[model samples]
Target: MSAFLSARRLALLATRCPRRTLSTTPRWSADPWPLPHTAQHLSNTQTPSDIPPPTPIPRPGESEETLRARLVYQSRKRGTLESDLLLSTFARDHLGKMDETELKEYDKLLDEPDWDIYYWATEGRSPPERWAKSSVLEKLTIHAKNEGKVVRRMPPL
Candidate 1:
């Protein structure tokens, strides 16, 4: 059946990229501007570069939101989800704190489901206040841990 062949092809594609592909996320650098801004402003510029800039992908559907929001409703407010608690503990307990790039990445995740969250979580930075209530932060932590990016931290003496 066509469905069976489609499923097989999907499996093959998943295997091709062992890690979640954040192809647009190069190592954060001071040199180049962030792609979201560039992509939005591209049409106004006089000289478009030879290589097209990355475009900001829109959320897939009504389901769009943070992993936390996807999993649980904040209005229920039975305190933070267990997953969020765990993520906070890890960042507060160790990871030596997040740098500017990591913080920006975390903030961006709250505003949007940009792939930047994966890098921020794996890099061990906490999302800032504007995004503190988001499910995207939860999803970022979950994915980073599930992908084997976790590290145990010793309590500060």
Candidate 2:
């Protein structure tokens, strides 16, 4: 009876404790669930560098209507809410009447960082020397002043 009980105890211990094999390779590599190929590639890919890509140039011989539509879209979609409202409102009011030169200038303004443009428009910070003489910047600043009307939302595109 004593020998039988000891055998039963050994059996229980054996069932409870899993056998661990010594392996030089990592256990994760042996996992049954494999990572998706795209996910694995992304994990190994280098992170984006600090330098921004070059600004996009307008398509050659683009129509004035197309240019205005593009600029209005850009104005309405500025990442920051303040700039979005100000620029979109300005675009709605002024873009249609702008000549080719003014439209080009406004395109250059859109290329600037949103916060910088916002500050310049609001007179919170004076524009840098490069932008000081920009007619588009002047127009944006005047619009941002909201002289008689309060601008609370982005105007429809």
What C-alpha lDDT values do all the predictions have? 0.43, 0.79
TM per prediction: 0.22, 0.63
Clashing pairs in 2: none
lDDT of 2: 0.79
Lowest summed-lDDT stretch of 10 residues in model 1?
70-79
**Could you tell me the lDDT of residue 5 within candidate 2?**
98
Q: For model 1, how does the per-residue alpha-carbon lDDT over 1-157 read when each residue is reduced to its tens digit?
A: 9999999999998899677756776585443543322443232322323544344445444322353242232112223233244444444432234443444344344343222343345533444455566554555556457557555332232
Q: Could you give candidate 2's per-residue lDDT for residues 1-157 as a string of tens digits?
A: 9999999999998899977879998868643543323344323432334545338685899998899999999999988677788888889889988999999889888987776678778876677776899988998888888888774676765
lDDT of 1: 0.43
TM-score for candidate 1, please give it.
Answer: 0.22
Query: Which stretches in model 1 have alpha-carbon errors above 4 Å?
Result: 1-80, 93-95, 112-157
